[model samples]
Target: MTTGSQRTRTVLHLPCLGPDAVPLERAVAAVLGYARGRRWLRFRSPGRPEGRWVRVPAFGWARFDAHPPSTGPDADVLIAEGLHGRLDRTGWHAVHDALVGLAPVVEAVGARAAGRPFWELPADEFSVLDEPGTVGALLRHLGQEAGPHPAHVLAALHHRHPDLVPHLTPTTRRALLPHVEEGDSGVEAVVHRELRANAGAFAELEAAVAAVVGDARPGRLRLHDVLLWLTTTLRLAHAVELGEHVAG
Candidate 1:
């Protein structure tokens, strides 16, 4: 189904970052708590979707082609766990491809990906397990292309306004401190400079979001913290999605 006529369900991708990934089992449980019984589904590259966790009525499931689903292209939402760095090509392809897809995919952007130099769009969503309202809002935005992660949006705001960074840090920045202080020249300058350069990408992203989801920017993101913190998960989500897009 195309975005206009497709069903809307919030999906989360969980990629295996590594042995040190802070236990996704715990993360999922936390997400469930945040969701408060909203229909949460999981899937993998079964084309037929044969293998999946079946426990609740709302518990839809998938079998990812990658260790986690964030790397996949067909995911409506991804919830991988890596944060140490950007996902591999497999996952990146999946996310880029999924962005091309008619549906919206939500992946967990890792902290490393967030803090690391980015000449590209931000995908950071590593873990907002602590914030239900924020996560809930993000679920709403999953259908949109969201070219820039929520973090990017905040970064733009931060670049223009520093005062908001403090209140925004909790849900936006997560645990990573700015490579330099918020207003420092290099980190601060690079982020905003890239943001300006990314006008086209952001436009494309917004177009994607608007095409699929209309003009409602529901979710919130920080340009550099939460995403990188759980960097491994993001990589994992994209890997899963890439296979789906390619096979399809």
Candidate 2:
């Protein structure tokens, strides 16, 4: 039932940004650029003699949890249903188990948030992220208690309230908030500022995605998460191949 143009649009289109946003186009172009770069690297790289090309896979969003699976439930599904689920089956059990203690915390924060998305909160209202004994602090503490992989705590929180939180992976922080130190009181606020400043761009992404995918559009924060994750990952890959550092 899909036409050729529609198929092409689906392939080139990244539903995370509005069609008019330059970043959206750039994101698509980045994928294409990666493909071309990989081909060039295959034929011309110091490591070409070492079978390095065999390790590089085609660039695509499937590498990340940008969207829920079409046939099976993902962590987001379990979180939405008020249940605990691990981001990784083997490693995240402790984080999920530790998360149980935070049910009261989640309830209190949800009540205070009153169903408003994080971007919609006024500046003064958003300052809770910087305060002691608040959601931000509790989350930080939870990360510490959970041990090893602190970033998964943020992932759990984002899955719980996709609109109220942005997923903060090490890669995302390094790529987007290099100056904001881990556990910094203002980390959440800084991320919020980034998202708020580009609200229009995300809105366009949301609209474009809705136009193409109908009702299955992911949350706006998830779209931002995916866009940053995808691009950062690609950059990291390219850097690794060249034996260069990925710029923070």
TM-score for every candidate vs. truth? 0.25, 0.56
Instruction: Provide the lDDT at 142 for model 1.
Output: 37
Best by TM-score: 2
In terms of TM-score, how similar is model 2 to the real structure?
Answer: 0.56
Q: What shift in Å separates residue 82 of candidate 1 from its native position after superposition?
A: 23
lDDT of each: 0.29, 0.50
Candidate 1: list runs displaced more than 4 Å. Answer: 1-190, 218-248
lDDT of 1 by residue, 1-248 (tens): 22422212222121211224323223222222222223335655647567564333221112111123233333322332122124456655544454454232222322223433233323222123433323223432332343434332222222222211211222322322233243322232233333344344333333333333232321212222222222423432332233233223
Indicate the TM-score of model 1. Answer: 0.25
